[model samples]
Target: MESHPPAGGHSVRTRSQHQRRKRIVQAAAALASRGGVEAMQMRTVAERAGVALGTLYRYFPSKMDLVVAVVGEEIDLLESSIERRPPGASTPASRAVDVLMRATRGLMREPELADALIRSLIMAEVQTPFGDRMTGLLLRVSAEGLTLEQASEEQRDLAGSLASVWVQELLEMLRGRRTYDQIQRRIETAAARLLAGI
Candidate 1:
């Protein structure tokens, strides 16, 4: 039996497909920076990426998909940056806090992009693959930066939970509901409590 290639004529992505995907994501990010996610219409993205409108849709079915892809790419870049930095302070809590702060500061530098990505994340349902991926990347990056030496299972779980809370604090700060100092206080207090039992 012969199976025809999927709609795109290839089951796996070719180099050109990869390039087109990258270009589309970059276009989406550029549009987001210029005027946030609302500015990222399918037509505008296709025009900016130099791909057919249908091709863009083939890659990202909707604005939400594009936003999530863009956010995922941005987070990948941030993860590389996080990995390259030297280890932080001595304790697991402080090291984790430092990593969280760096991530927050990076987002603060690009308020519009941050808002667009975070907005998409908020709109995405919890069970969606995009939301889960975004959340998982955040947790992995934060936990990777922590200094968990011979940590018990409970402490390891606490570190991951703390990472999510740190990300939430960042979103709150981005929304202008909380000052950076306030976020800092909240995060520090929470991290302290999480580590107290260790």
Candidate 2:
């Protein structure tokens, strides 16, 4: 499938344009936080952001795009937080578990928003720009947690696998197929098993 550019070919070349895009994303996030994906109508987001509907479309071509952008924003915040306070566990596996657990707890606190973001991610096409960005962010963050310095190829592979498990566990939690305790135990077990030799 041919992947569409996230902004539908629109580029932010000025501070005003950047701010406008920010507002649209912020509005979308607020709505999702409150009422999940169903509440994030494009027109409603525009009204909330105080931007024209057309302007919102220019920045985010579709509701999925907007939701993905909001998820990106959330991950960006998580990345910054991790950078400020790297996981303190001595082993790579324990540290990765710490980071994943932190992420799980944070998202669970905003169940509606987490549901919206995960739904968008699951709906995204394979190899799409949004999918790629989200995957990259997850891998990078997980790898960073594994090692504050540059991670080796083995470490990176472990991080990728652990990240995949974490996402699937989160989906199960969203579906009520797994409790929070189950999700945490599964993630911890997966991380320990995957990173056993590292």
Model 2 spans with C-alpha error above 4 angstroms: 1-11, 126-154
For each candidate, what TM-score against the reference?
0.79, 0.83
Candidate 1 per-residue lDDT, tens place, 1-198, comes to 474322221244577777888888889899888777778888999999999898887877677877877776777776677678743566655655666677678778888888888878768653334433333443343455323444456756676577667768877877789987887788778877775544
Instruction: Write one digit per residue (lDDT tens) for candidate 2, span 1-198.
Output: 474433533466778878878888888899999989999888899999999887777677777777777877787777788779877776666777777788888899999999999878778752344433333444454444334236677666666677778888899898889888998899789877887766
Candidate 1's TM-score reads 0.79
Clashes of 2: 0
Instruction: Indicate which candidate wins on lDDT.
Output: 2
Q: In model 1, which regions exceed 4 Å deviation?
A: 1-12, 126-153
